[model samples]
Target chain A: MATSIRFDPIRLPPETEVLRGEVRAFLAEEIAAGGFDPRGGYAAERFDRSFSRKVGAKGWIGMTWPRQYGGHERSFLERYVVTEEMLLAGAPTRGHFVADRQSGPILLRHAPEDIKQDILPRITAGECTFCIGMSEPDSGSDLFAAKTRAEPVDDGWRINGRKVWTSSAHYADYMIGLFRTSAPADDNRRHGLTQFLVDLKAPGITIRPIQFPTGKHDFNEVVFDDLILPADHVLGEVDMAWKQATSELAYERSGPERFLETIEVLIELVRVLGAAPDSRGSEGIGRLVAQLHTLRRMSISVAGMLAAGEEPMLQAAMVKDLGTNWEQALPGLARDLAAFADSSPTNRATFDSVIQNATAVAPKLTIQGGTTEVLRGIIARGLGLR
Target chain B: MAEADTIVVDVATRIFQDLGDPQTVNNAGDDSWRAPLWQALTDSGLTLAWVPETAGGSGGARADGFAVLGLAGAHAVTLPLAETLLGGWLLAESGLEAPQGPIAVAPTRHQDRLTLAQDGTLAGTACQVPFARDCDSLALAAEGADGPVVALVAGHDCAIRPGLNLAGEAKDDVIFDGARPRLIAPAGADRDALMLMGAAARAMQMAGALQTLLDLSVRYAGERKAFGRPIAKFQVIQHDLARLAGETAAAVAAANSAGAAIEASERVDAGLLLDVAAAKIRVGEAAGTGAAIAHQVHGAIGYTKEHILHRFTHRLWSWRDDFGPESVWATRLGESVAAAGADELWPTITAA
Candidate 1:
């Protein structure tokens, strides 16, 4: 069978250039105002509500959504430009990044009208934050193994289980969690999982900090102890979260954030290498730049596919598989190339610090947003191999 | 690709399918198939597809020629179609008429240079001149007293010592010892420009070969069984094929972007250089990784000389070395990016 992978070379339209300029200017202003340090990754990992609100004020959040929900109703390409610029500038986007990237779109598609009216505007205004509750104590990549149960209680369901590796759960206003509503059918293990919109401030929920090896408190162990949710909080089908989950991942997996997470290291690499770098340094920089350009083009092509309303799941998985691997490798590559740099270059300290942080953070690039193994499996299915 | 470009690719695909099927060529024990394939390509005006109508060649768009090369790559045709097309384009660049038979360009390597004597003779030794032994003429880009000049010289005037690439194609060294040219004119492009063009051509070809590899690996995985089921049922093999597909997509995307930029630009500029260099480097990387994975998925059958997998993989390896290897291009591109400073990196990439 012909390979289904299609990355038709899609160029961003001219309008994107305008949006990019505005984004750069705004990011420059924010950096100047000491909102975040562009050279450091520490600011990037932190959830800054004020910074998110400012970004929302610029009408960048929920950019592609309808105007009625505080969105500008822009094209995906325009949103693409804004997202990439924010990523490259190291702007503190963690507060609204998840909501803007996937949660808002998921809600717009599957949430009830009242819920949408209540939450979409808050998300667009950067007044609300979202944390995904997919991974659990026993289930990570095998999402169907999730045992977090949601039992019917009075006018709602009570969720009683734990979700591990939940990013931003401690600070999030809500969580779109997956809970087991029924037993799996004989042939379909992926059956019976239901999605629910749970208010994080509700009773009987505990958010314990799960520190990464980098000593970053970006992840949380969220335990739900009979957490009550209204009946209308159920998203999409009652026992079919799997169906609702598959389509939204393409948006999550194929964004610029997938690849540009550690781009500061590359920028630091160039700074350390100087203008007339040695052959080894120059070649290393060149190869990385080339790979980065290729990944961006592929990512942008996927974005264009999304804009055209195509579900390019295989293509999206491929981009993430390659993109994450490349970004993860950047730190080591940068270290090797920078080894010969003058020990006292002007930004040598900054370069060393960035590389150190990137090294510690690189391990999660492949694991956090669906592990490499999971994505490859999805791609394999797309290739008709399974 | 545009609709018109698709038509051009379709035409080339049809020609290759009818005469240059890889399996058919692999099984044939003689040189009987080469003649007809070359004849079909020549009659279709694809050999000189890049040359303008005024230059005594087909007046097709540059993008169309690139698409044809990509098709030639997918088929892994042994004929010197890309070489001939490149040579004709070089001749046409100097306002010279392309000859009727196949032609090869000199100084395929960046360091190899041809010099023009005051007496108007071409003098240089060009190494790794693809298909030089088989070509009827040589398109020489010689450094003249005024500047670089493109000279058309008959192949017989030069001494050709033939060599073979990893794929066993002719990669000869041509020694032009004061060879007189039939026609000579000032070349508008420089050595770098020619190298960029050649790199773009090779990148497109590699992309096509990668596509073929992905298809072959997937098809093989589906049919070949190991433990009571098709090997494709295994997760590891499936992941291998998936990774190959990703590499193949990267190669295609990078090569197509470069080709599109070249077609859209009126002249070769720094922006075009960035696109071409990135394409060459990224596609070359894909070729190496993709080929290894394809062979791994295919097992011993793919490793056998009798298998058609070797044809594409060998050529993928060989093409990466042509028009400068990935390291060389990466080094150049890196230096340029560094010279532009760190801030310009994003702007440079976006421009590409």
Candidate 2:
């Protein structure tokens, strides 16, 4: 057991618990005021600017960044509380989620001073939206295979390529994209790719909606045809984006979002089953709750590790692999457990709609962020199997 | 756990490495290794880790004792170390001193009940009592005339029916009819609390065993060759090992978290129950999944008695059934959650 992974039983501090209460109260007030329907999951359809602004007003976005960069200088655990509470409530956080979760951190870490000063405050205020441009027509999980070129110009670089499955690209003001600044080294295929902060409003950039079967327009294809960017827009060192891209994965892969995506179905299942469910329903609900609780404990442990400045890559991958699979299985289990629920019209209708949405959303839960195979491979590497 | 807590586990691990290596013990195929291992544990005062110093035992922190249990699981030591520590803790709770040798707790099964008669005698039968035949003393939690009472009785005074679990460890049925106790006092805890404690300990052990399974699976995958290459080179074997690692990781997290919560809490509330129940259920589930993958990776070797793998897989299978199986805990946890209603679910979960 020499390679045993450690996920310490890290409990939230008292301050984080206090923050959790405040966030819950804020979400409750918003729900009461009809800011957004709690039933609407935080999909692309739930991108509400006013709700995002309200959340930003609460100083939740960019919570762990430096104060000079408009962050509140909060702990990662505090941000974790806010994020999880929002997800549990199914709040319309899509408008600011990427900026708050990922983009802000990347900018704070890699962007130049002027870019940070200009965009950080706006992001903290929930006025800016971001999209990632890593996945292209040719590259998704194999990020180094990106053919999006950013040839050097006199002033900056001219970008030309297509980025597909870019979530929120249609509405995003900026994109933290990966481009092929040079050819990959023969011995190291992970070389040559570079990260840049591309202004989405620049000329020669086209955003076309990639609608889902339900007519939902979340994914998009962003074509960068001779889009010009200043030299300063290059995030971190050129042709060395691979180094920076991996450092944020532990944070990205192990968040509460990995597991809470389809929680609405479980919650609804409990509601429809009433106070005294039969043995079948009770066992089903218990197993789900137990699994969910275990995942949270593990996720929070990872957050604790992040706060302590230790990168628990193996533990984080384990959490995401288990959490996403648990969430993906929740909708179907809920359907099975609620098979004998009361047939009252309202109960049946509520359960039906929730389960249907959850079922529809299940396939992408494992695919997005990182696919299951990719995550397991990361875990295998951590186990020293490769 | 703090750096200070791991010292206890380190001691246990060293002792086990010296006298209780799984492969060595498996090869011996006799009870010869048991005596020295028990002697080493006793000499180190680990057997009384949970008992207070005033109770004639080592007054270690609860977390330290739990860590030792987890280490015991990792080694798959076929001794009654967990049972003895649990018994000592139960005795200390009632201000009673633990005896010298191994101790087994009674009323281990979920439905089994023992009672303290007004005449100061123990009555009733407890099934699935671990190491009942091997222990020198029996720590019984029984329904007294007034309330719950903790009683310590000599094992030889009771009727013991020897049985074996999946791992061939002693899991016996003990009958106490009019057996007078050496010490009996009102307990601050009930049967459920004891069960929770046992469940948490078993979860930690299962977590430990799961880690070993992962280690064994990974090592075997790397060493065993198929189609002119190490099996680990195959994407499918790598993925299976990864899944095993996931299960192992979950078990460790859940089990350790539950042990921590139990150590931190003052009473057995719903929050504590949720932590303990989740640990048992998740770790038990992990045992099944992890054992299968370990065997799958080893092919026929892991399935044989000669291999050390079965020692762990069998213990994992057996330990899950002790205290209560996953289904029992799941039902109790589900009932508690439903009783709290839908809205309180999130809060209950976050109460940690």
Candidate 3:
């Protein structure tokens, strides 16, 4: 595909329809043998370790990674295919997702050789998982203003600080963290920060789950009470955490997942409409269907840019901001449509679940990733407004 | 390609920037919000743009026209430019010379009955005609059991009960009672198809209008001061204006993509319809946000009809509900996707 989308549509050469038979069989075996539920729990957010390993064993995990790293070396489009299937199945890929999709790559490019060789293979094999630790007490959007300090001590460093909004910190084995290694207020706020690979089991580190109003333990507050790390744990270079953190964020923030989150409710709304939807429903369904498709293309295009290593920051922001609205609307609209009833039980259940989830966390979608305001600020800058 | 597209948008920007010029907008009253500017557009082949060269038209595409009109909408043009352009094209395409001056074709289904006398005298009455008094000719749907016919009746032919659209465009309850009708196109034609075209035109125009309101409101927020600094310096206003700008941009971009696809295909694609509907939803959303944001930015002046901000906001406030609301489109889109399921979804979605 040409770099710019003008007349032609993009055909991601690697995309496959994702055969249901194969996925079903693999999932069946995992359910029967690995003993996992497709819908794990009420608010299942953790990655199923045994299930993930089984999936990784099935050559599903890191399908897009290079073969040398114990991966199938499938294309990003192929990875997208697998991802959509997993989400639709409500499978627990969350554990390895960060590692397989994001961190492993971050390590490959910026991590020291020892860390990459050790972590990447384990991640691909589903033997390891990683959590992100960036946001601090006082620093949210101004993340570079991190107050977490690390002092060089002999052949290692001692770290002391608190981190909030650290989701999955309780379950992950390793954390990709940003700690201030230099003195306060370095001239280059961007450079004073440094990323470190911290072992979650390290001494003097405490993890406390912050229960949301929804009673979900998805996010946690973790504190480091002078935890020690070896010299080799540093990613990239000392006082260069900002660059590594930036790359990790670009990976975390943009993806097909961002836009596809609300699709469950969307599909449910359609199924309830039955074979022949009334003209009113048809208009509404048709419009959403079209937007989902258009945004998917735009997002896939962004993913392609990432696959080729282009820093399409503004484009990603555009997708996320627009994607946020679609994601948020899924629940409220589903509830309204479902209120009509007369839908099949399966359709109702699907709609009900999606609505429940959507209603609970729709507000977070805007605030998470990045607030709507921040994304627009980025977009305005892209449009040369600032 | 992106750069060139930006340049086209730049042309629109230039048009809006000229609004402060002594351009007889206030005098156009409801219709002349920016008449001189629109006239400039016509001179530049912006109006009558959807017509083809084969029929003495601008030979320009509707999507291009949509882009231009969006800017015109942003500038708060007083006249019913889209109705005229699209309605005129329908008449011209139906083998009728368009009304040369100030015309508004219904561009809607109407046609209770059309009867022909032995002397080739055509007569019929349409239920309702848009901007009827403002139009020199009215293009309406002539009644047909099989399918509706395109009947272009001279404005003088019908006894019109003129009224106003919610935003003040002239709407008339047109009575063709024993009146002569110019048979433009045959009966039993594709009303559904033509309506889609008309709808597409309306959606693009509305999208433009919403976009203008959003831009103006954001600019106001940035320039207008409250307390100490520009009001935009506050996080709340910034957030509101930012959201308005983002969603409006999305709507504009979405509509542009659909319009481009339609222009490329030349035939109505199901996917294109989906795109058009989605654009409608976004346009409505932008209008809601845009109007509210505009009002908030303009503060007290926005509520007063005397203020120029109301000119843009009023159009946005009304146009947002016209055609359809976002909820309507959302449900439609949900249905289309559900009908497709997982297998058909990839191709249907990725196709566009």
lDDT by residue for model 2 (A1-386), tens: 66778989999988988999999999899889887888875443578888888888999999998889889999999999998998889887878889888888888889999999999999998899998888987787787789989999988999999999999888889999989999999989999988899989999899999987677779999998899999999999989988884548889999999999767787788888888999887888889999999999999999999889998988888888999999899888989988898756897788899888888888888888889999989988888878
lDDT of 3 at A233: 85
Decide which is better by TM-score, 1 or 3.
1
On TM-score, the leading prediction is 2
Clashing pairs in 2: none
Model 3 vs. true fold: TM: 0.79
- What TM-score does chain B alone reach in each candidate, compared with the true chain B? 0.97, 0.98, 0.79
State which docking tier applies to candidate 2. high
Error (Å) of candidate 3 at residue A328 is 4.4
| Model 1 CA lDDT for position B319 | 95
Q: DockQ of each model against the real complex?
A: 0.80, 0.83, 0.21
> What is candidate 2's lDDT per residue for B130-239, written digit by digit as tens?
99999989998999999999999998889988999988888999999889999998985667778988999999989988888888888888899889999998999989
User: Please, what are the lDDT tens digits per residue for candidate 3 over residues B1-352?
Assistant: 1111454456656665665231246444543434566666666555677667766666666556666666666566656676677665666555655555555654354123454444535555444445678767766555443345566677888787877666676656677666666655653223444454555565666666665565566666667778998877776766666666555655565666556556666555354656666666666666676677768777986677565676666766655544345665566555666566634554465445
Q: What is the DockQ score, from 0 to 1, of model 2?
A: 0.83
Order the candidates by DockQ, highest first. 2, 1, 3
Q: Please report, in order, the local distance difference test score of every candidate based on alpha carbons.
A: 0.88, 0.88, 0.65
Better of 2 and 3 by lDDT: 2
**Which portions of model 1 miss their true places by more than 4 Å?**
A42-44, A343-345, B1-4
